[model samples]
Target chain A: MLNIVQRFMKRLVRQFFKKKKKVKIGLYGPPNGGKTTLANRICEDWLGEEMGSVSAIEHETREIKIKEEISVKSGKKELKFNLVDTPGIATKIDYEDFVKKGMSEKKAKQRAKEATKGVIDAIKWLDEMDVVIVVLDGTKDPYSQVNITIVGNLAARDIPVLIVCNKMDLKKAKKKKIEAAFPQYDVVPISAKTGKNIDKFYEALFVIAG
Target chain B: MSLTLQFVPYGEIENLDSTAKVNKLIKIVKEEKIILLEGRIEKNEETLLIKKTMEEIGPKFKGIELFVMYPKDEESDPIQRLKKSVVDMLLGNRQGLTIIGPATIVKEIRKDPDKIQLLTKNLSKRKKTPASRSKSTKKKTKTKKRK
Candidate 1:
């Protein structure tokens, strides 16, 4: 009788874990590089909702936000994963930078503290990521210290990466520049704000994370 | 493995004038070498670089690539990470290179991160004879294009 109950409990636990199993896909990058915007775009496409709010201000997302069971289907192919949107990673964060953007001193300092903590939390969570998408500004130069560090850590961990070169609708957006910068990784150029070439972004995700 | 060159700015990179730094970057990239930078460039400087590289140099040069490093906190231990996670029930903290090379010979940059693939074929490096070139260029418009 006890053995029957133990076997039943074991099967129940196994089913629970199997139901909860989902691949983790993380969106990571610098502040205002549109990590949240892209996250919102993906969630809206699959889940019919947004993951989090976005702002022009830096470090607007000071905590890790997650949306689960986002299953993307392309024809017969289906990819299901948990989407994690992390705070922008910066080597330095200063309250004065926020102050210059017209934020009050007290709020700016508070934001800085939270943002700094957020950065650490993002790094800690890297170990749990099954795949990572490093979203970047296509108009900006790809060769920067922050970009290197993020890619390097991913490389060290052997995690798959899909580089999203966002903001391609702008005249200054140069997807080719980003391609040249990180020739090793696959890069998908898209305008998250305008939803340009988003289909290609989805296609690349199937190839990369699927 | 392919040949690569790397550059790291030591302390006080900010003291240098932004324009001069961009000019220096342009000169380095034009040399057709794969180079890695130590840190992120300023936003205005990054914009200036893309504008200048595209407009002045034209299609021959491939665009710049960026890689950002992950930040490290005070603790390196796994136990400490878990402990902090528990403490984070109390407190919190957070978040997140340059790769430059010429396009023609350097084909793809790989996961090795620093390694670039170079073309084994020497077709682009070959010199052309005028008569042979003229014979190949049957179109008159094509003949005058390069000159």
Candidate 2:
């Protein structure tokens, strides 16, 4: 059929262009998992700028933001990639949750609408990523359904993954739990807020990207 | 006011493809029923299921909570593992349990190596009496006036 041939041509073009461009490193995780904080950390370390804003509220980064031409170095080796900061993926978006956080009902409804679209966008962007950094709140259980879904999608795509167990500065942050949950992937514990063990994260990035 | 738990055996959905299987599951969850599936789906199917759930989110239909529990092969002996592989090849992997529920009802689904614990939301807390509603409204008005 004409549609099948067109699809094949499109995929071929995408594959050819993918090899020509810089590696796209994506930050993906559940809502409020400190993805934007990690994005800011990476951008500030390399470009002396922040990618987006961070908030205590969930779904704060409800759009996909990208920082191009970020070249990370570990000793003499350097890896060049475009760092993509995606909205936190979630299965549910309730306006009442924002209202409970002291947002007006009208504003909460608007946020919920945007968040729903954000989740869809995040999923759609999964296929375009060359590498993904899955950020998890270290204090929470890593065996949640959302975490499994995110990791499973990456595995299915055969994309290299690096799981960052963030918020290590918190007393309740148990790095072992995340390690135990996902033994297949390399788990690096870091406090994105404090930049703790972030060097190790960059070091591990080279290994995975290689 | 009521909760429904739908038990679906593997035979019921064995013939369906991945998209069909996810669609069937989402259709049930959209009706606010918790599904206790006999066997676990593939990893890619789980991802597809989440994508479909996000697409269907709305005011009334929130989303779904999914969990799967299976026996760990690491704990089994080599012979036992071989037997499981053979059986799995013959009859599919029907040794695991999958739970999918509407997020409006299921608050969380916690799983360890051996068991699954499903925590439901407290629906009673959402019901407000007329007197309590009026009292809260009056408190809000007083705060607005003070502001």
Candidate 3:
């Protein structure tokens, strides 16, 4: 009789919490894929502030940053959610790579250590995401193992995904390649740095988050 | 400078659970051997393997390059596809090939409808040029020729 009562109470509490929770939108991709830049763009546009720092170096965002209660207006419709900017996921992180990029050996090792933890945290947080925006560097090949793994995880969880092909400002940015790589998801080509075609991304969010 | 390719039959890992199967593959990959697995693991297991790989990243062990190729159902007729599905249900879905290798060696794995390509990096040549000496050498040669 006690166990049955406990189960009933647990179900009621879960239902109440689920109704009160905000939709969590996650920014995920490989390192240096402009995830932070996009996060900053969204925060700046909606919340009137930046979310995190952006850098040219890989693994710069070594922690998960969340901006809550962002309300976006599209015409007469409005959507509200919490934005999550996760660390760039990578299968490999060698301190030697950082050393070659002009960091001291000690700092390189420290960055590498933090980066591995960041990847693990990003994967663990996947279960909490309501919608995920997969940011890919448009100048690079989209047919990579890291990209595959991220997409595969999202598919397994049945989460809605929007692929953002960032860096469309660059001459080498190939949006077509990204489209071909992930034909299932809606691909939005935008330059988060230059703020090009970002409006289209905002409009697409309504359909995806619906 | 030597490369090793270890072929793992489905029977070898048929009894192991997802974690053990991933661990076995990682152990072989950490030794710098390329694994050609007879069957592809589950999608969730692939994600688990990636999570484990991220945890194991360190100085000597960089990570892994993985790719799986399976036969497409679109090529078959509806009846043939149904038959294939029934067979798969009974015998397990072992109609795919999975390739996993250390990232230090295997650079990329490209796949098409009909074939797959595995690209490798030359570590010895890379070690010889601590920095990207090859690019600097090319620039020097170009300047000399111009002079």
TM-score of each: 0.56, 0.87, 0.85
Off by over 4 Å in 2: A1-19, B126-147
- Which window of ten consecutive residues has the lowest lDDT sum in model 3 chain B? B123-132
Q: DockQ winner among the candidates? A: 2
Clashing pairs in 2: none
Clashes of each: 34, 0, 0
- Please, what are the lDDT tens digits per residue for candidate 3 over residues A1-210? 674787577557645654789889999999999999999999999989999998888999999999999999998999999999999988777888899999999999999999988988998999888789999999998988678778977876667899999999999999999998888889999999989999999998989884
Runs in model 1 deviating more than 4 A are A1-20, B1-147
Better of 1 and 2 by TM-score: 2
lDDT of 1 at A173: 92
Question: Can you rank all candidates by TM-score, best first?
Answer: 2, 3, 1
What's the distance in Å from true for residue A97, model 1? 0.7
- Residue-level lDDT tens digits of model 1 in A7-93: 577557644553577778999988889999999999998999998999989999999999998999999999998999999876445
Candidate 2: clashing residue pairs, number = 0
